[model samples]
Target: MKTYRSLALIIILSLSVNALFAQNKPSHTDSLMKAGIALTDAGKFAEAVAIYDEVLKASPDSKPVLYEKAITLNIMGKHDDAIIILEKLLTSISTPNVYAALGDAYDMKGDFDKATSYYTKGISLWPKDRNLWLNLSVSYSRQKKYPQAQAAAAEAIKADPRHARSYQNYAVAAYLQGKNAEALLGLSNYLMFGSNNQSLGACNVIKSILYAKPNTNADPVAKLEQETIAGAVTVATAGKTGLAPIDSLVLQLTASYKAIQSQENQFGSSFFARYFGDFFGAIATTNYMDTYTRFIAVSLSPQDNIAWLKAHNDDVKAFNIWLNTQKRQTE
Candidate 1:
């Protein structure tokens, strides 16, 4: 519930809230909308919807209000109510936000096919909409269609390379398909955007993959990948004593990226070699690894690294500038 509710709120707030205020200006609808948002934030979802109903009674054709009301209904586990409002909105004037909300409502109702249909329709209308692609990928993943999920996630990433959620979805989809290298690369790119509560868990998964032993009976590519990761861990930790955990992680990541770069030509233009290998390989050659390490660590342990980020604002800025100018391989 938290997952879908949170995503629905993002779409609602991003597409509707500010626009509602901007268009309404100093109207009473503005005040009511704020109150409704406040109520929704305070977990008084019923009160919030009632406030939206009040606004709609006065300004009966308020699309933003309608969309937000539907989202709040979703958060309150009223998917049928949300679906009713969203479907009506779609009939009058279709928009990406309405499509996304409708898909989310159906998804929460355990109707993946309906959710996928709405998402696909939204993407067809707005091909550059990363959120639509992301949701479609999630729907496919829920149906255990890993390849389709990965392809949709790749489309999301190509649509908006800077969006963290795109990479996060891509990483999960790739990992589910047993493409660990691609998964690691996707996670690395995702971390570059920022960190959140998900950061620590992602970091732990990364370390586990880096340290896992090679499977003797695996295919050549998988076997080589395992060996590369295992060897990177040894190279990172060898002759090192009392290294801080974050420092150890930085060493291991750099070692792994460098090792992948070394084998880029061996794998020719395979997805991992062409995309993951070339991208992180470029970073391995730069002096930004320390800055990158601390940047991500800020989310891993805020108490320990937040001040470091604050104190080193220039470093963070420089690293971000370098990262943003770099292009990712989307093919």
Candidate 2:
């Protein structure tokens, strides 16, 4: 009886130890996952993969770990490897993120057809996902299917009205389809909410076109153009010193010319000719006329004019400062 009791006590103690370890196993796995995610965030992709491997050895079928490893692989440009993992994950679980990731992988591989199919599948499963719609729009745009791209972009916009990417996609599709008016509107909307150099360049091009035409219809495009110019003038005049109104006008025009010159690549000589008349002709004609009129009205000697400009140099400096501020803000 004493030997049997001793054996039973040992068995109970062994079982309790095993139960405790079993309860702590998941905690250990969680720690491994957190460490892996940190490494991934720090861009140590290979190290993150190794940690994930350790976690997988414990939890062999962890969907979250598998998905995270696949994303890290994708970031490492191992699109094929990422796709393989994601495809296997689909066999066990069907999630929108997995499908979207597969679409991204195929898109990176230049397999737009496969990307589109995956994106469509994801969209069908999660119709309200703006990102999937945006991805679909991009894929369609890549195929030069502007109409379909526009439709997808519109859907993305409907899903999240504040998302700037949808507007960008819409602008591209509209521009490709020769819908200049709609393209300009979309670009303007993008500029209002987002800051991208490419979008800024496109906005400058569209603004140059509108400036050349000067639509009398009071359309949104015309209003945007007017507002842009007005904003520039406002910034330029913000540093007004003891200069006369005519002097201020001259300073504003000078600031405007500098602004246009800064983006000369976007608005070329043709744009200048169409909007402000020929560059050389404007210098010879309009500029000469303005100078003569100012000289006669002010009746100041060249030295006096120089002195006046030197005194108001702060205004010019202010305009330049304002322009730089705007560029930094937009970029």
Candidate 3:
């Protein structure tokens, strides 16, 4: 579960144990709270709820105890119960602080309109808060309210011009609204926001997700191959053994791939020369020069590179030949 975010709630959470002991004379409350927090951290939320309830009953008007109980209830998937406590807090407190908590609570209940109302209340009262609008946008989106979601995302962008998640949400909202080209552009902006220039792993993973959207009907098998190929590219580019001073080795293979994608696009692998529109030069570039000629058996078909690798071979030529021959063909 995405934990609710509100500075006042965080403040309350931090001082909760202190408030328990200081306001109520010495009791077993702090001990219970500590035990409850510890157990909850250990994934024992059910046990934690029992202890939280005892503490709340002992201090009926205590917001700290009530909030902690609500938190544990949420962790236990008791969203309705969590909503009750948070809503009750809202009525009695009626402050920006309470509005923030109520916003989070309603979001958990999936009562997104109320959540948006409360979040709006909090944002209006606390305009300088950097996090408020993003919180509102996410809640709006969970309910599939695209227009409202876009509005909230715009507000978030206005609040934090460079926020990456806001950009991603904007793209999704665009897609939901059937604005595919704009969605792709927004998604590209989201990718450009990242600073993973030196990390091929992140590059490949993001590229894989790019074409996996349902609209494109991209094949999962081909997607997996692209991702795996990218990994090998990353390892090669990062200079991780296999081929020493491997910059040339990596670049030759790099020519096998299209640029890192922000939307679904195909790589022209020799294995699918027909389907992917692969050219002989590109195939030869991808297939290591030495391996292409060497891996061809007497029958002229490429030998299986896996069988060669399994015996602890480092023959780059064989992999290239196998890769080229595997080019896509119509059945």
Candidate 4:
């Protein structure tokens, strides 16, 4: 089975987190910083680095310029260079942002020990910094230290109860440890406040497991399955213009589901039978797969998929209910 790892996701989230830490500056440096950011956004990393160099020449101690330069280097896969800059920033300025960046840089370099150490130091300096706690949680999770990961995630939640990513971190840690109930609860909270497509995909996989297991507590499983079904419908219907083409979107979705199946298949027939075998069989028998493929093929655009799903909402709902009913009957 595929191990639950979030390194790629953490790297993606770090870009936005760095953006939030960008400092305000005087007009000259501000313009340079903005230009660098634009270049970075346009995938012109070398140009962004040159612009940052110009900003640094003007104000050698410019925190914003240095911070953004480090981020650009990170995007360029220069983790060592980024770490050198971040460590220098920490020596002159003891801000949580610099410490968190240092931690992320080390984590990217696969030095989880140093990453956890820096994250802990950052948390000590800023007890209320939820992102530090979240980063610490991820570091621990990556190291397979579930108890520490859970504790760090709990601290993040305590710092900011409404932060959706904290819940996601906790859910991933819990899921890896086989704490299915806690994982489901954390995932539910994450889905409640976050609209990211990746989170939706994780929710669907977790709900599929819950729906398949026999001798499990029925109440929470039923409630979570229903919520997952409703959330999938909502996501399917929320597309707008300018999204990926319908065929591409269909390919992406199918690839993601296929990954889940591949992971489950590694555990042999008993595990498959207990998890996804019956689930796949039921959907295949109901012609749901045929209808879904047909819809994807005929949809004019990504938005048209939403309209088609809405028009067939009743059928989709019926399939969900029937699938769950079949699972329960077998149980």
Note the Cα lDDT for every prediction shown.
Answer: 0.77, 0.59, 0.53, 0.61
TM-score of each: 0.83, 0.54, 0.47, 0.59
Candidate numbers, best TM-score first, in rank order: 1, 4, 2, 3
Error of 2 at 173 (Å): 1.9
The TM-score between candidate 2 and the true structure equals 0.54
RMSD (Cα, Å) of model 2 = 19.4
lDDT, candidate 4, 61-83, per-residue tens: 87777887887787677889988
* Stretches > 4 Å off in candidate 4: 1-24, 212-331
lDDT of 3 at 276: 27
Per-residue CA lDDT of candidate 2, range 207-310, in tens?
Answer: 45333333355545334444444454567778677987556645544444444434333422232223222221233223332342233223223456445545
Candidate 2: segments with Cα more than 4 A from true spot: 1-26, 29-35, 38-42, 194-199, 208-331
lDDT minimum window of 10 residues, candidate 1: 17-26
**Candidate 3 — which residues are off by over 4 angstroms?**
1-35, 38-42, 94-97, 157-167, 178-331
lDDT of 3 by residue, 5-87 (tens): 33223433444444333345346566887887777666688898888877777777876667677766765667788878878
**Model 3: how far is 279 from its true place, Å?**
36
**lDDT of model number 1:** 0.77
Point out the higher-scoring one by TM-score: 2 or 4. 4
User: Which of the numbered candidates is closest to the native, going by highest lDDT?
Assistant: 1
